[model samples]
Target: MRGWGPRAAGRRRRLRFDGWIAGLGTASGTRLVVGHWPRSPFGPFSDVMAEHPDGQRVLLAPTRETADFIRRTYSFDAVRVVPVAVRHAGRTWTVTAGPLDLRFTTGRRGPLGLLLRAVPGPLASRPLWSALTDRPARLLMPGVRTRGTAGRGRREWYGARDLHPVVGVTATWQGADLGGLAPVSPPVRFGFGSAPRAPSLTRITTTVEVGAGEEDRAG
Candidate 1:
C-alpha cells in the first residue's frame, strides 16, 4: 500500500497487544517495563518462554495481574483486565474489560528556541528561522530522530513477531520540555489498544459519575 493510508492505518491500530511479557528486558541497569503492545515493528510479544544467559528457558507471568512482584515493582504503569458491571434498571451485568487510565510522566516546558537560547543572543534564532522556512530545516535541528518502519526505527529494539487482534488502542503525546534540546513530545496522543499491564483489579476499575437534576427543554 502506498500514500498516507498505510501510515494512518498503522497509527490507528497502534494499541494491539499480544501479552504483558511483550515488554520484557533490562534497560539502564533497571527493568523498567510496561505491558502495552505498541504498533508492529514494536511488539505483541510472546510470553511463552524467556531465555537466560545460560540458555535456560524460564517461566513468566502469562497475564499482567498475576505477574510476580518483580514485574509489577519495576513497571512504570499498572494495568488490568477482568469483568465490569453496570447498574441502571435494577439489573447488573458483567463483561471482560481492560481499561487503561494512564498519565504519562511529564517534564516542564523549556524555552521556545532552546537551541538558540544557548547561541549567545537571538543570532541562534537564525537556525530556527531557516529550519522553519525550509521544510527540511526541521531535520537539521539537533536531537531530532525519526521512527522507522518494517522492523526498523527505535521501536525495533526487539527483533520482531506476528501481529495480533487488537480490540482498541489510544496514544497520548503531550509536549516535552527540552531546555536547550529539541522537542520530544508533540501536542497530544494516547493509546487504549490493551491495558499496558494487568495488576490488581483496584488499579483498573472504571469510575462512573452521575449528575442529578436535568432541566426540561421547553422550560
Candidate 2:
C-alpha cells in the first residue's frame, strides 16, 4: 500500500462534515445510531444505521451519493437510499428515515464533554491529533476510536467537540415500537469504532481523506 508522504499527501483531498451523532438502544432489542450533518461537501443530509437483534446491519442514507460514501467508509449488511429527515428543537432530536421514527432528548454536557470542549477546534480536528488520541479514547471509552482506516484507500478522523447524555428516547421501526431508551449494548459494528456505551449525543466533526489521485471520486 502507498504510504503518506509529501507526494501522496499532495494528491489527497479532505472532506469534512460537521454533525451530531446519536447512539442508543431500545427495549425492543434494536440498536440505532443516527448521524445528522448540517454541513458537508455534499450539503446537509442524515443517515441511520440500525442493528437488529438478529445482528443484521443496515444503512439508511438520504441519497445514492451519501450511501456510496458511507458504504465505502463502513460495513453494513444492507444499504438503502431513502428519504431521511432529521430535526431538532433545543436538546431534543426527531428523525424519520425509511421505516424508522426516532425521537430523543439530551441532557447537559458532562465532565468529558467539558474536557473535550476545552480543546481548540483547530487542534482537535487535526488528523494527527485524532491519531494520537485513538488509543487513549479506547481506554477512556471502550469501543470508541478517534482515528482509523476507512477502506478504499481513505483514512478517517473523528473530532468530538461535546457530548451530552441521552436522557430519553422513543423509537419505532416498521411501525413497531422500539420501546424506551437503554444502553447501547454490544456496541454498533458499523465501522472501526462504536459510540460510547452509555447512550449519548455527541457534537463532532468527521474528516475523511481520500488517497492520492482519488480526490475527484471521493465524497
Q: Name the best candidate (by TM-score).
A: 2
Task: Write the residue-wise lDDT of candidate 1 on 1-219 in tens digits.
Answer: 121011222322121122222212221111111333222122222122222223232323334433332222222133333332211121111111233111222222233324323433223212233234333322443322112121111120111121121122122112321122112122101111111121101001011111122111110
lDDT (C-alpha) at residue 141 in model 2: 93
List residue ranges in candidate 2 displaced over 4 A. 1-8, 215-219
C-alpha-based local distance difference test score of model 1? 0.21
Count clashing pairs, candidate 1.
Answer: 17
TM-score of 1: 0.18
- Per-model lDDT: 0.21, 0.86
